[model samples]
Target: MQRILEPGQIEALASRSVPRLRLPDRSRVFAARAERLGALSRGHALQGYLELLATLAAAQHAALQSLEVTLPNESRRAAARHHGMPVIPALGEARSSAWRGVLDALRTAVAAGNYPPAVAAACERLATRSAEALDAQADRLLAVEVAVGDAAAAPLIMAALQVYWVAMAARLVADDVGVPESSGVCPVCGTLPVASIVRTGAPYAGYRYLHCALCATEWHRVRIECTQCSATTGVAYHSIEGGSAAIRAESCDSCHGYRKIFYQEHDPAVDAVADDVASIALDLLLTEAGFHRASGNPLLWQSPG
Candidate 1:
């Protein structure tokens, strides 16, 4: 079903709004994400794949429990104001040990054997890279991300590293950043969003925010407009005929782009990555209709749309 509204009522009309600032509780993010991953794995269309992801999420949670990171006191204020590209890559240069710790843990997780052999090989290679080598590799992967619209060109291990590293930077810099972001891309790392969430809680009712694929940051965007082009016209939503009402493809005629929108009201278990990964059927439906996605989930390494 399609939903449209007059242009003036939405946030995009503001043209320059503040980033919906948030700092993830490192202690809670992984565990909560693990739960969502588990649920998706147990009862979703991509069950086997989701189960592997669930394990990976749990591993990430464990790694976070022991991760040691230091945040700089300086803020990203000037950069935010100018919409400057993030100075930090997903594999930030600050702590080589921190990156190693995450990669090492991911390698162990991949070796545990539920996933395909290729995943195991990638993690092994990831674990062997030196910090200097990894830095160059990170740049290459990011270049590919830019070229392919976050497609899974890099291995899953690298995607995991991107999320952890970028998330750490975003958290450290989040408080210092201010109201200077109103674009479709992430203000923190300049990455496209995985998907948008319409939260379930009363305080967040009707609020819509795009979840960052690399850094796990969520920034608010208007509900009725096309996230890809900020178009208010020719926007329609499509969903599986008998599936949950909360999830749908927000399609735009202007850009012919669509992104998945998850309504937490109907599915509190919804997660930016987990739900997006589980909904392969919906993606197929939208693709069949010639609508493309603007961004993607890191775990799935989806090509645009």
Candidate 2:
């Protein structure tokens, strides 16, 4: 099992830093993008109430950034994902449009604002039924779509949820069972981490935390080794001009894998997901260095084919 800093440990580090970094306010951009996406996604599965929740979550996150609220732990957030539960219908020996219908209802609820309590009740019932019917493949696809839709309309909210989910999962494993050798992958959801952070401060200063891509959990990994191959050889840091202080890509020559590191010291408001999306230049530079990313970001790859 790998070792990780408890949630309290991380908070202590955040509290002690002199001249703590300030985050940015991108709420306007997020709101504008979300509104445009809501319009485009009118007929899609992410319409209505779900879309509204996503938008509100994004706005709230932006506000939280401005207020410097320490975000919820990852484990608690992950639980919510499972709790909210995707509305998949049962194993349809036939393809079910139930999922689509549920999305439509959610959209309707968000846009119309006239959906009664009965309507919400009906939608919830349908969502539960669909989830039971859908296969794992369908479920995963739905999860991706839901995430993408939410991100398009509410990037900050989606990002925060992602982080919360991972943290919750990590807390479960680390506190209950113990950390695995490859904390590189999210133990709870079996997804790759977005980056490996070199955290500073007491009880675990200079420790490595593998940040989850899906749930945003940060699990402890040992320092001075490659997360991909567990190799201790030829690990290096590369960064783009001017962006070096804010973000850097940690490359492992042995495994040909690289992860981005966000220096919270330099910018407290730096969200791993939002800032990562904004720093494509750094990714380009890391890619040019022959290091491939172990994790994936949908927004970073939305270029037209």
Q: How much is the lDDT of residue 183 in candidate 1?
A: 60
Best by TM-score: 1
Report the Cα lDDT for candidate 2. 0.47
Model 1 scores worst on lDDT over the 10 consecutive residues at: 144-153
Give the per-residue lDDT of model 1 (tens digit) for 66-113: 766664324544554445545343434443556556767766875786
Please give the distance, in angstroms, between residue 282's alpha carbon in candidate 2 and its true position after superposition.
1.0
The lDDT values for all models are 0.68, 0.47
Question: Clashes in each model (backbone N, CA, C under 3 Å)?
Answer: 1, 28
How do the residues 1-305 of candidate 2 rate in per-residue lDDT, one tens digit apiece? 98898965885676554222111223333344344444433554434533444454344334323332222345644443345321111111212333233233333444344545654454454345433433343443324443332122222223333323322333333323222334455544445666665556554455556655554445566656677777777988778776448577778878898777767566534445445555567778887878887666622424222
Given candidate 2, what's the lDDT at residue 131? 38
